[model samples]
Target: MLTQDIRQSAPVTPTQAGTVATLMIEEETTISDAPLFVPEDIGAGLLLLGLLLSPKPPKER
Candidate 1:
């Protein structure tokens, strides 16, 4: 989400007072699958995780 501040120069009606307004802007979106973490990526991540979690041999004194 994004936002922008907008100030009115003058009020439309004599009885109304000028006011500041906030204009909400939509966040940019990309079509890339990296952020989505697709199935294939999840699989690869799990494989890497398994390798990291594997037990190592005891170190000799």
Candidate 2:
């Protein structure tokens, strides 16, 4: 478990909260002509599925 002193670092003030909120709103309003998603090869998915289906090794003592 973590100690108490490590958890008492600086907390955000109201002023900082307002600034962060403003920045977030500004970012949301901006739009880009860039593509949102890129298409991947079918083989890539197969490779990942193969890895997930493979059996794991026995746990070490």
TM value for model 1: 0.27
- Residue 49's lDDT within candidate 2 is 98
Which digits, one per residue and each the tens of the lDDT, describe model 2 over residues 1-61? 8766656758899999999999877755566688756556577998899899989988999
Task: Tell me the TM-score of model 2.
Answer: 0.29
Each model's lDDT comes to 0.67, 0.82
What is the TM-score of each predicted model, taking all chains together?
0.27, 0.29
Query: After TM-score superposition, what is the CA distance of residue 38 in candidate 2 from its true location, in Å?
Result: 49
> What would the per-residue lDDT of candidate 1 be over residues 1-61, giving only the tens digit for each residue?
6797888785466333223222244457766765564688589889999999999979999
